[model samples]
Target: MDAKSIKEEKAELEIWQYIFGFTPVAVVKCAIELEIADTIESHGGAVSLPDLASAVCCSPSALGRIMRYLTHRGFFELHESTHKYSNTPLSLRLLLKNGANSVAPFLLMEASPEMLAPWHRLRASAAPGGGSAFRAVYGEDFWDYASQNPAVSKLFDDGIASHATRAICEIIERCGDVFEGIGCLLDVGGGDGTTLRYITEACPWVRGINFDLPHVVCVAPQIRGVEHVAGDMFKHIPEADAVFIKWVLHDRSDDECMHVLKKCREAVPKETGKVIIVETVIVEGEEDEYSDTKLALDMVMMAHTEKGKERTFEEWDCVIKGAGFSSYTVKHIGSIFSIIVACP
Candidate 1:
């Protein structure tokens, strides 16, 4: 091949990456809004562009663009002979109505313009003494804002539930053995006890306490065989054989995390108890794409909240041991996140 051809090819690949990357996410959000997956699924298996547009109540021209993009991205498969679009593996996983592990909620939550717009103001938040982009733009903290907005709160909760649906399965599969001996477990900041509920149903002998803010717990529907405790993790955590903190610590500063760890230490007995933390330990090596995604998520945490970012193993160890924990174990759960067991 000629030099110009190779350069052109590289440039084309870069352009495709940039264009297709954002376009598909927007299309995904559009699909959610239009209930496209549900519509197509309801229509047997595949649907023509015209039918899909009719079902979704959008113009055929615009719908064609969205469908074409999705098909190219492998979210939907287009049969060349008949021009029908079928749900691909990606769309099937994202189907909101009856998916085995629906990520629709999380996708919708993050991709919404309200959430995505904040990234634009990230530079301002990076200024000295600046707060998170959420606070800077909305004039209130995320939790505080959610407290007043029912729709937004539900969206956030549903997103967390969706996350738990996928991550909890891996957690149990890889770290299921960790729960074997524990009599009781506490899920700190566990919304609606999704993770705990999954665990309790999996292990009938073990009981769990779902601990969170009073208002959050107040709104949580009572799950069978789980105790709902309303309290602040920084101030206190209900006593349990093992305290589980899933996707919680990354949203706080080192100081705040330490305080939380100290409180967790108080909640469980020293000899037999441990604090199980499910979070990303930003490690070197491994799949470059996966690590980059982890780093991007850390930037999201940093941009959206004060004193929050993903940490490394050394960072976690400092906080755990500083909080008086004797030892800790990092278990690769094979999910997007990992588990850290800290013994007091």
Candidate 2:
């Protein structure tokens, strides 16, 4: 009611926003591992802190700090009676083993030291015409490390599969018509055939080829009805009616992407063929919070991997034409991904 009181409340709210935003990322990650969200929900809204700690295999006293932190962040609701906590809608969305928006695996994988280590040298990576952070840290590129290290490779592969499973399912249901009349489909750089499997299942009449490195394909599991072809995309791709380059081009420089696209163009006949590319076309002046996330990803690509980025629609057109394609059609696929079908 008073001017002083209102001013004090406004200042406190602003301070809380900064505090919550900075710390919740770590706490939310911990909650995912502990299944704290599911545990509280299983209790039908509210759960005592002691019971929550017991479910997560942590000492009650030690867990209390994390619980209080999350409660302050609005992920958990604290009850005065028993000092118990309840799940907020935000926490429920992150439950690893369950929930409609299960981003737990993606969070864990991306938040790992292997992925986060590059950020430590982000400033250097952002310097004028710098190389990737992976090269800076490991003295080698991502594919080189993935080929040599099995554990790291498995983690990266599993994380992609987990995210793809959910995302591909939604894409198929929403944009299944895109595959109609597609005869032979080549999945360029298709890691382990996860997307290929989804495509085959959705469009039964279409035959598919899973193309990636020989090493990755050597140990890759067989997917029925889809042929596995391992080779270099820069060299040549097998002939096909349609070439599906999903999330592949973003990991390379403009020259490198042009080379790959040219090779893809050579593989498919212009009159009856197309190259389907799935990636983000970053739009300038976008006001969405996720736009910032896309920019952050672009930096990650710059730091840890080879030249890659979230390009805008104009950039997409320029790159496609640079690769010798006459025109292309872009379609939104999933929340953050887009499908661009380029034809010469």
Candidate 3:
């Protein structure tokens, strides 16, 4: 091929990467299902292709192809001379056993057919008066479907909890000061009480209320010093010294957030109480390590919810003001989320 033709062809392939990017996601899901990372880690972080394949009960040739692609994608490392595989830092995070911060469940859920099917209908959902692609494909809202399907509900819960574990830990370490002087804390829409469990454990003096829908509270395991309560956030929230809402508002419209924030304002004392919100705040013209994930999640929110979308600082200010909060402050936590403390 001519030099110019070759250069153009390479550029086109780069563009094609965006079109076929789901390939890596699907492959990662396969690795999770087969516990490939766990298998390799079990063998002291390295294993021959034949042995690894045997442990996973798959054909060596097929598994070899999978490993080749994973290694090419930096998820694993290959020892060329020995024809063996080992876990990279990325792969270690997917290990099911004894691996710190495993996101296997999250990967599994995102790569599931149930989740991917909705993406095909994104254009339709984006049209005016059109609803979520999830609803378009499933004939019901994502939360409603989860309510009816026990398995999906469990997966959803587990996936979210798994993903939140590390983030919640970081928040406590980096922003634990937010809990000081709080006698009672209410976790609005705290699914399964995971976040509160961490908080109450870290701050033993603080009592926590895990508030969510009745069905969600019914399945939450009881934790000492954390009380589980069932109610809608739109209508009422139990009184507390501090009310915490994490990853909830982005799944709602401005009108809905205003309603919930108003309830939050009512739940806390005007003198000292505050509302703590943990979510992604998109800032225009600002680039960081989390920019890509934040933007990608914004799209995911659009595909899965009727009106939910990420907000900027100005948008957040508008909602906080609309809810009658007098002042607020934001602290960026890690790379993906921010902690906004709002006071009445």
What are the clash counts of all predictions, listed in order? 0, 3, 0
Instruction: Give the TM-score comparing model 1 with the true structure, all chains together.
Output: 0.92
The parts of candidate 1 lying over 4 Å away from their true place are 1-21, 95-100, 285-287
Q: List the candidate 3 regions with Cα displacement exceeding 4 Å.
A: 1-11, 80-82, 95-100
Query: Which residue pairs show backbone clashes in model 2?
Result: 48-84, 133-303, 282-311
* The 10-residue segment with the lowest total lDDT in model 3: 91-100
lDDT of 3 by residue, 1-344 (tens): 99999999999998989889879888888888888989887898789998998999999899889988999999898888887888888887764634558878877777777788889999867788767888889998887888888778777777777777777899999989999999999999888888888898999999999999887889999999999999988878999999999889999999999999999999999999999999999999999988999999999898878788899989999999999999999988887899999999
lDDT against the true structure, each candidate: 0.84, 0.80, 0.88
lDDT of 1 by residue, 127-233 (tens): 88756788778888777887788778777887888889889888888768888898899999998788889999888878989998776778888888899889877
On lDDT, the candidate that comes out on top is 3
**Candidate 3 or 2, higher TM-score:** 3
Q: What is the descending TM-score order?
A: 3, 1, 2
lDDT of 2 by residue, 1-344 (tens): 89999999999998988776636667777777788887777887777877777778999987998887777877777878877777767676555446545666766777777877777766766668765777777778889988898877776776676677776787788787778889899999887888889899889988999999987777778898799988999888999999988778988888888999999998998798888888877878775656777787787677767677768888888789999998888987646778888997
